[model samples]
Target: MATYEEVKDIPNQLDKYLVDVRNKSELKETGTLPASINIPLPDLEKALNLPDEEFKASYGRVKPSTEAVVIFSCKAGGRAARAANLAKTMGFANAKAYPGSWTEWAQKEGK
Candidate 1:
């Protein structure tokens, strides 16, 4: 699990597939990480696509095309870590969990 600062600094470098596992209500209330795609744990597979067709075409991107570094974040660390592990089992070689997710980000104020 990466710390908030550690993850935040290089988040853009990991833009290929950053998945935020926060629930819809939480996302509406607290917002999300930059370039993060929301895919609740239950809907992960279904939502596993490029951010959008326009962006994908312009950026020369496609999802599930490679074993990407999929970073997962939830309210706290638990769900994200679980999602990361699950992603690994599902063949994503570089899945990581941001343990200090929005809860810690909110506490910092600058995030």
Candidate 2:
């Protein structure tokens, strides 16, 4: 799993989707890190398969290539790591799981 220190310096590029896999209620209870897109782990495959225009229409932006940086996060490291592994199995070469997930982010952001 990627550490907060590792992912913190990653570029906030438009094509990269910082995914928050925690459910909607969790999202509502605690706001996500800046730039993250809420596509719970269960929906990840479908979301990634969308065509450029459709994706932009649905997700509000286009995603990078399967080989590009795609960051995943959850309440802690476990879920995000599993999500990242799933991404890789789905052909996303650069998918990374943030070990310092919501808890770490919340602590750092003072949420």
Candidate 3:
């Protein structure tokens, strides 16, 4: 899980990598972080089958060797953590979960 400090630093680090796991409804309701790609968990199975060339074409050449960190985020911490763990198991060694997800972001946005 990412700390508060890490969340604060995301904007700067985002240029390198960031992935948003919120569903379509959630994304439509709330704006996402800059450069964050929407990859809903339900769609993961389909994503796995995407041709490597297609994946690279769409997501900018992500190989097992890609150095960018993959941060998964959802409404709350739970789903994001699950996605992060899955990503790690699937060879994304730098996957991380943002505990302060949309719920926290929404609360802060109100203030």
Tens-digit lDDT track for model 2 on 1-111? 666765555545555668888888889998877777788888878888888887778766676588778889999878889889988998999898998899998788677
Give lDDT tens digits, candidate 1, residues 14-91: 545667887889899988876777778887654553365744563344564446667788998899998888887777
What's the TM for model 2? 0.87
Q: Could you tell me which residue pairs clash in candidate 2?
A: none
Better model by TM-score: candidate 2 vs candidate 3 = 2
Which residue window of length 10 is worst by lDDT in model 2?
6-15
Cα deviation of 106 in candidate 2 (Å)? 1.0
Best-to-worst ranking by lDDT? 2, 1, 3
Over the full model, what C-alpha lDDT does candidate 3 score relative to the true structure? 0.70
Query: Would you list the C-alpha lDDT of every candidate in the order shown?
Result: 0.73, 0.81, 0.70
Q: Model 3 compared with the native: what TM-score?
A: 0.75
TM-score of each: 0.75, 0.87, 0.75
**Residue 67 displacement in candidate 3 (angstroms):** 4.3
Q: Which stretches of candidate 3 lie over 4 Å from their true place?
A: 45-52, 59-67
Angstrom error at residue 20, model 1: 0.6
